[model samples]
Target: MNTIDEFNIDVRALNVLLAVLDTGSVSAAAVRLGVSQSAVSHTLDRLRQSLGDPLFVKSGRGITPTRYTLQAGPHVRQLVGELRSLSVGPPFSPDEAELTFTVAANDYQRDLLLPPLMASLRETAPGIRLQVMPSGIPNPEMLRKDVCDLVISPHPPAVGDVMQRRLLDDHMTVFYDADQREAPESLADYLQSRHIGILFATGERMALEASLSTQGLSRDVAVTVSNFSGLPAFLKSTDLLATAPYRMKDHLLKGFQRAPLPFELKPFTLLMLWHQRNHEDPAHRWLRQQLIDVAQGLES
Candidate 1:
């Protein structure tokens, strides 16, 4: 097999190709790389000339990577990752760092955490860019395929090489418009009422729902929305109920009245999961610490 030496490209050129492949467009790659679109195209031209492969071709509305590009993409990603780990120079400084970090989280966590996180980054690390993606149940393939830098979810991918840490703990509680109806008084009452619940595209059941199922119980979900943000719309001014994390009172599901579940269920921990490759990376460490601080601030 041919190594990167055969391509006659430098690390910068490899990064250009990688950014293009990772983002699926020259324009988006430019944004990720903090450069102009034309500059990214020029680098791709250089890569094509050096490697004798078109690398990418125009697809319907966007672009699609060529077979050569797809085959070599993983190797290029690994090489760039290896090159980035070399800390032979000066100490790390967040203000001076210019790179993109991808985070996978659903709307609940996204709305709760990203706003404060972005404000902190804008002030302390002006050059850092956060690219957030939805994390549905957080499967191992997300980390294995280099999908994102970190995952914020209750269900961490059960992989040996993945590192996870508890960020915060919260339990589900019933949410409803008090103007419409009183809170359910028992498990039977909770099941009898119409529910407006979250239904992610991944079809992974929420931990609360899954646990209830284990006890031979389930909600009569009359309406379903993609994320927690959509719950407020259907729940307002109606006799509908929702069960979401208790912290949501300060986040997305504000103004809506909440009550504890009439039955017993253990609380779940929100966790931050990352691949083993990032265990010792300084920038990654700083990002994780910032998240820890943000989570701590929420409770105080």
Candidate 2:
């Protein structure tokens, strides 16, 4: 007979077990974790020996969590959360601390906000590295899933175990090429001219379009692009217009010119979001404050 006191249990094993439980299959869990099924099976084997119970059982085409797993699942998830929180120590010195953070933002936010923020971080927190992922729309679960440390967007998650701060708000303005087409001086001219629509990956219309629809007004959208980065290619030589936030005026509209929207539209607010798990972490709090400071400086 083999004893259960041979191996040490770690958080990675716990996470592997929870992934298996949540996915209901070792292969599926492996796919989610970017690991091999054999590795997941090995982790499960070790966990079974240590816990003195088979946490899962094969059932026909798939597997099901056993009674032990049913009871321990919630506690294991909580344990993983607590373990993650331990990374941010109480004494945080930006000059001496080394850390890596991931952020998600679309092209507009990425271009408008990150350059200045990076300059500040390089000057103050030289040891920190920032990775930015493209954000299609606001999804707070990225923080809960530990995929990113922060998310910047106009549409923040409305309800969740997350904290959000209003960074700044900007009104909508139409950007057009002055050399190709004159600025629209009236509502009819704005609506009749060809426009470039910025649609997200999910096929969701922008808030600007929604505002126009509410007023029974619509633009003649000739082309649709996924982000603001694609607009310059189409707008520079053609008679196309792009309605975007005014904050992008300095960075996104260098050769282009902006004009007031012919119709009234509500200003959109950009928000910074982080998980509640990081709410009290000193390092995370410091980074969040730095972002807020950067945004305030731009606003002023």
Candidate 3:
């Protein structure tokens, strides 16, 4: 077995090769490495010359790994993983660790999760900073590429090389302004009323539709917005009602009112997703566990 030193392939070059294999394009890999596309292409050329095989060939839209490259890909990825793990120190002490973690979540989860999360961070992990970004359905591929440090969503993403843990289950609930109209007494009334649909760009709009279809009823979606925080303001003057997770109801509509869904909508299990790259990092593990605890303690 030839070691990296014997092959004259440094860790940086191996990393560039792994990035190309994972991203399937020199440009994308370059972006990930914060280098120009030409640099990635040159690295690939060097790797091919050293290995005596065309590692990747241009496909219809992107590059495809050759048989030899495919065989080596996993090994290279594993090497990078081992190196990262070895470099990481003991679990980070929240009070002393200066770190910033990026989390992607939908507006509903953001409403329910952020307040308590921030409060906990302020009290216990003040040195650690957080940036909450709006994420649609979680994308494991993006997570693996380090686009997001964590994803908090109803369903775990279906990307390979990622880990998921169920945080809590949140059921759907209906919300409307306090004085807009009387609370819907039944599913029939709920379906017939004008409704506001909150649509995340990547989420399935059919979940609510399917639930309504079961009762042979449907909603008149007067407006479709991108966030739950705006639904309360939208319902201020109209008879429009909004539906969201039960946990989000109180936080999103603090001054508004809510009622149970007229029809039985299955609860969605919220899961926290992270890349395998950070699986062994103590700080990462601590943050993940803290989120699970906060989510589990929510009243829903």
Candidate 4:
């Protein structure tokens, strides 16, 4: 077996390994690394030869990590994270820095966060352009791969290695057309009304359903969509009501009327998450601070 120093593994190869481990397949790793599948395979071969072990092998359909990989994965991840931290230097100067940051958030967050955030950036960091990517929920592995610079979600994932900061507390509200006659005033009335729910491909829609069931009532789901932005449009044409965060109601559906949720639901925290690898990056720190400031201003 080669010593850690004698191994002389290329940083690029280590990066490839980390990507594959996080994504669970060579093809996926290739996409994340912005390289061809052949390149990822070649790097895997080199890593296997150097390590004298099959790091990953094809299982029934997908690749599974071998014993060696399972043991070495954490160390490799930590090493790569440390290296990335070392590569990032001082805080970026807003006026001089040329950067495009990608942020992952849902439509509700976009409504509440983007307008003010853009205004602040225009006044302070005019050179920085932000790209908002629609994200369903927090995924730590994706954050580590730098798929998004930050994730703004209602709840943080249970992963310990990721760093999270609470931006705001979100409470539920029911929205309906302002001119609607049969506005729901009680849980029973709400259950009788046609409801529209915004659900992603992978989301916790069942949780809301289950919560309603506990109250001995169920919503008649008239429509299911992926985002809250479209709900107001749907409500405008019909009496169908939708449930969403209170913070979004004012921004997305200005003319729509909202009422408190009939059944009690716990308030959820909106958190900003990033990989531990970026925890110390000066530019990342500045961005995180700006986000906090924006959220605080909105809440105030």
Candidate 5:
């Protein structure tokens, strides 16, 4: 037998050896590989020179692998298999994948967006799991710490390598129980009204409060809550007004009435955020696109 380092080796030559051994005929192996018989024979000659083994011998009208080739066949098959696996990344198939994703969202985004997202996932990626966590004023540290895969928020991180896209822009509106009180007809009426305000964990007051403070006017905040979902309960039985996004009419403000804010408030833009590391990942891209689609559907 020749020394292992004496002759150059190639994967195609190894494959030819496996095919010849399995079929016990060069012509049949060539058919399996879509090659001419002479090509198969030439590959076999190269493999024989490299390994210094008469890998096959004539037997009647067919062929038989030598004892040496038979003894090494399985190991050779494994080596070829491993080499193939190393040649490329496996393509992503959402229908066949088993994956879990996490999202950080405030109660507003969670209630407004995720239910439709989950419903869509159920149809498109049955094997995928979803986890939603509170995203109280998202920052880059949350992503750097691997706290969540994506964040849905109105606030965007100020740090670099944090990617974002605006999902929708929503203007503030006054939500109230129509049966309890009439909608505020003027800025003076809105300011005089008792309000239920949202206080984020970060100590950043809601945009309405900031806007009012900027104009040297403020509302009588009779109650403070953390999430939009709870505003309906407070406003449902009383004359208290909840200043919330117009989109809340479909979500948290159902059975309540909403009218445009009596004063001009700059619209809030809801954004989707993710770390740079996940930007090019196929599964992450797919989920992002799914969210974009859901947002578009909601707007339409």
Candidate 6:
């Protein structure tokens, strides 16, 4: 008998053995694994030498497993099943879960959705903890470097491993202090007015400004702030017009009058992003669904 270590058999070789035994032929097993027929034959030969058995023999036009191979088939299948199961995480139960997750979001998203997300989690998953940080001009590294589990933003990083879904859509609207002045009368008036713009600390303009730039339009910014939270202070009792998402009317820019933009622009969608590695994780999926539900509930 040969020592099993001398042959160095691994899970792939074991799968090949089981494939041939199940299909009753080497060629069929190769087709199953997308390998060449000779490759299957070579694996069987090494497995046969390691086990001291002629695992298969010709049976008329096809092949049949020998008595030893037949006896070991079920055990090989079980071993392979157990080895494959190692890749998956254990089961998750939100009620009993004790986990912490970080989410990257700007003030608009932080105020709009996260409060509802927290309220929902408190009712269903009290054991989980949340740590939220600013997601200004979100980048793929936030997920790749484990900085955060999720990012809520209009911009999605241009990386293949990053995945995103639109949480909700909002159109650019003219926000103004009704007591100070009314919305701009026309495109010319809108373009000429003093505008309040959001410019992140890193010097990147927000999505609305960036998108407008692509279409050869620009804002005459008399005031610029680092976040959406600061826009309200600058717009009060002033003729300054701030073009922002209409959804903000009930949240950050409450009591401000809203009117449709005088010019045509595509509606911007707020998106949620995550790393591909967590796409199938049980806990991640649960939280992701929770966030989506909150966004959807707001939409409805």
| Reference-based TM-score of each model | 0.69, 0.71, 0.74, 0.71, 0.70, 0.69
lDDT at 18, model 4: 81
Name the TM-score of candidate 6: 0.69
For model 3, what is the alpha-carbon lDDT of residue 40? 85
TM value for model 3: 0.74
Per-residue lDDT of model 4, residues 94-178, tens digit only: 8787888899988788778877888888988898889998877667767867889899887776764578999999888888886
Query: How many clashing residue pairs appear in each of the predictions shown?
Result: 0, 0, 0, 0, 0, 0
> Candidate 4 regions off by >4 Å?
1-87
The TM-score, computed over Cα atoms with residue i paired to residue i, of candidate 4 is 0.71
- Please, what's the RMSD in Å of model 6? 12.4
**Model 1 clashing residue pairs (backbone):** none
lDDT of each: 0.85, 0.85, 0.79, 0.82, 0.85, 0.86
The root-mean-square deviation over C-alpha atoms between each candidate and the true structure, in angstroms, is: 9.2, 6.5, 4.3, 4.6, 19.4, 12.4
Query: Which tens-of-lDDT digit does each residue in 11-43 have in candidate 1?
Result: 889888877886688997787667999999999
In the predicted model 4, the residue pairs found to clash are none
Pick by TM-score: which candidate is best? 3
lDDT of 1: 0.85
291 in model 3: Cα distance from truth in Å? 1.5
Cα lDDT tens digits, model 3, 1-300, are 344454767778988987787777789788877899988888887777777789999889887999998898888878877878887977578888788999988777777777788899999989888898877766665686777899888776554457799887877778788776988988678878899986756656738887667767767899998677767778887788888766664566776678887666677887888987788788998999889878877844
lDDT of 2 by residue, 71-157 (tens): 988788787788877876568899987999898998888998888889999999999989999877766558767889999988867
Candidate 2 off by > 4 Å: 1-90
Error of 6 at 195 (Å): 1.7
Off by over 4 Å in 3: 1-6, 49-53, 89-91, 136-148, 154-165, 176-187, 199-218, 222-226, 233-240, 254-267, 273-279
